[model samples]
Target: MAKHSFEFKKKVVLEYLNGEGGTPYLSTKYGLGSNSQLRKWINAYKEFGDAGLMHSRKKECYSFDYKLHVVELYLTSEVSYQELAIQEGINNPALICNWVNRFQVAGLDALRSHKKGRRKTLDKTNSKDATQLTKDFTIDTSMEHVRELEDELLKLRIENAFLKELRRLRLEDEAKTRDLLGSSTVSEDNSN
Candidate 1:
C-alpha cells in the first residue's frame, strides 16, 4: 500500500465527512489506487477520529499465543479481517491477514518472534580455548608479516646493488670514450 502523509489522509477523511464526495468520487478525484482503501480511511476516521488517520510511530509486538489465537479465530469463524482487527484492538487489519498468511505458509514457528540481527557464529563453550586460539592467531599473523617484510627488504637491496653496478659501468664507458677521443686528436696533431 502507498503510504500517504497525515495531512493527505486528514484531507481525504475530512472531504468524505463534509459531504464533498463519496468513496468512489473522492478516490477518483484524488487518484487513490483502491476505493476500498478510502473506505478503510473513512472507517478509521469514525472509529478513532484523527489519531487513527495518523501513522503509528511505535510498533506493536504481538506474542506467539496472541497471534495463534487471532489466526485460529480467523480460520474457524466467519469473521472478516477488519472485524477481527477491531475485536483484537489492532489498528491495521492487514496485520491480521499477514499473520494468517505466515501461519499457513510456515507453520507455528513462523508466527514466533525471531531474534533481531545476525546469528553469532563463534562457539562460547570454553573461554580458555577461545583465548588460546586468539593468541595463536595473533602470533601466526605477526610471524607471517615479519617474513613478508624480510622478503621485501631483500628484494630492495638486490635491486639497489644492481642499479649501482649499472651506473658504475656507464660512467666507466663514458670515461673510456673521452680518453680515446683525446688520444685520436693528439695523434692527428702529431701526424700533421
Candidate 2:
C-alpha cells in the first residue's frame, strides 16, 4: 500500500486526540501498522503540537535546502543525471533524472519523497513557483490548445465562405434588377 502524507498522519493524530475514537479502532480504520504507531502520533502531537506530529523519526542526511540545491545544480548546470547520482552517492541515476524532470515540471515540491513519515518541506515561494510552472506546462501540452486553434480557424473559414456567397448572391440580384429595368425601358420606348 502507498504511504500516507504527513498531513494525513496529523489528521489521524488529531482525530484520536479529540476522543473521536480508540487507538485500536483507529488502527483498524486507517489500516495502520499497529496501535503503538497511533499512540506515538498522539504523544508527539501532545508534546510538540502539530509540528511535532509532522516530524519524521528517521534521520535524514540531506535537508530540503540541500535537495533543492542539488536540483538547481542539475538544472542550471546541465549536469548529467548519472554524474549527479555518482557525486551524491545515489544508487539510481534514473531517480535523479526523475527528480530533475519533476522539478522542472512541478518545481521544488517534486523533489520531496512521498513517504508517510517524512515531513513535507513547505516553502510558499517555491510552492507557488512550482505550481505555476506545472500550470504553464500543462496548458502548453494540453490538447485544448490545439482544439481551440482549430475551432478559431474553422470559424474564420466559415465566415469567409459565407461572405463570398453573400457577395455573389448580391451581384446576381443587382444584375437581374438592371436587366429588368433595361427591358421595361425598351418596351416603353416601343409603345411610345
Candidate 3:
C-alpha cells in the first residue's frame, strides 16, 4: 500500500503549486517522510497531471530483454532516469538507474534476475546421517567445554594472585600499624 493517499498527495502538491510552502516545509508540515517524496509527488503531478499523483499499486515486472533494451537506451541517449522511467512506464526511476549501474559494473548478466532468498540453504543438518550429526555435536560440545574450563582456570589463577597480593598488603599494613603503636605483635605464620 502507498504511504500517502492520492488525495493527500494531490493536496500537498497543489499546496506547493499554489505557493503555500516549499517541498521541505510541506513535507514537514504533513509528516510525509522527506522532501524528496513531496518533490516526487510534485514532479509526478506536473508531468502526468492527476494520474501521476495517484497511487500505482500494480508493479509491472519487465522481462530481461526489456531491461537490457532500457539500459541500452539509457546509455546511448542523454535521457535522465526519470524521463526514461516515464517513457518505459516504470513506477520508479531508481529501477532504471539500478539497471544502468548493474550493466555498467557487471555487463548484461547482471540484468537477469537471480533466484531470490537464500538458495534453500543446503539442509546440512537434515541431510547428514544421525551418527555424523552426533559426532559433530560431540566434538563441538567437547571443544566448548575445554574453552569453558580454560576460562575458569584463568579466572581462578587471577583470583588466587589477587588474594596473595591482598594478604601481603594486609600483613604490611599490620606491621606498619604495630610499629606505629610500638607493639611487637608477630603475625608471621611459620607454616609454609
Candidate 4:
C-alpha cells in the first residue's frame, strides 16, 4: 500500500470524527485502502494525537530474539519491508533489510552487537608462529612480498625511462633552437 502523509492521515481522521462520513465512505472517497486503515489511524490519533499519525523518528534497539523473529517472519511470509516495519514498530525499513542481510550472512550470531572502531592490525613480528610477537623482528621474505616489490620496482623503472626520454627530447629541441639562432646571427653578420 502507498504511504500517507501526516497531514493526510490527520485530515482523514478529523473528517471521520467531524461526521463528514463513516470510515467506508470517507476511505473510498479519499482512495484509501479500507476501513481498517482508517480505523488504525483514528485509534492512533486518539492515543497519541498528531504524533501517532506521523512516522516515528527514533532509533529503537531490538533484542536478538526480536531481530530473529522479524527475519524469520520476513523469510516465511510475503510481507513487504514497509508492512514489516509497521508491524514491528520500526521507523526505518532499511534497518529491517540490513537485519535480514546480516542474518543471511552470519545467521543469528551476526545479530549480536559488535564493538565499533577500526580492527586491530595483525602482528607482523610473529611470522614464524601463530601470532606470537618476538623481539627479533624478521623482514618478510615471502614470495608475495617479493612479487609486490618487483611490481613496484618495474613501475618505477618504466616511469624513469619515460622521464629520461622526455628530457632527451627537450635537450634535442633546445640544441636545434640554439643552432638556428647561431645560423641566423651569422647570416645577419654577413648581410651587414
- List the pairs of residues colliding in candidate 3: none
Residue-level lDDT of model 4, residues 21-58, one tens digit each, is 99999989999877878887886677667876888766
In candidate 4, stretches whose alpha carbon ends up further than 4 angstroms from where it belongs are: 65-192
Q: Which ten residues in a row have the lowest lDDT in candidate 3?
A: 183-192
TM-score-best of 1 and 4: 1
Tens-digit lDDT string for candidate 1 (27-61): 99999977899998887777878877888988899
Best by TM-score: 1
Candidate 3, which segments miss by more than 4 Å at Cα?
113-192
TM per candidate: 0.59, 0.28, 0.51, 0.38
lDDT of each: 0.83, 0.69, 0.77, 0.75
Flag regions of model 1 displaced more than 4 Å. Answer: 121-192
- In angstroms, the error of model 1 at 26 is 0.7
The best-first sequence of candidates by lDDT reads 1, 3, 4, 2
Cα RMSD (angstroms) for every candidate in the order listed:
28.9, 26.3, 23.8, 22.5
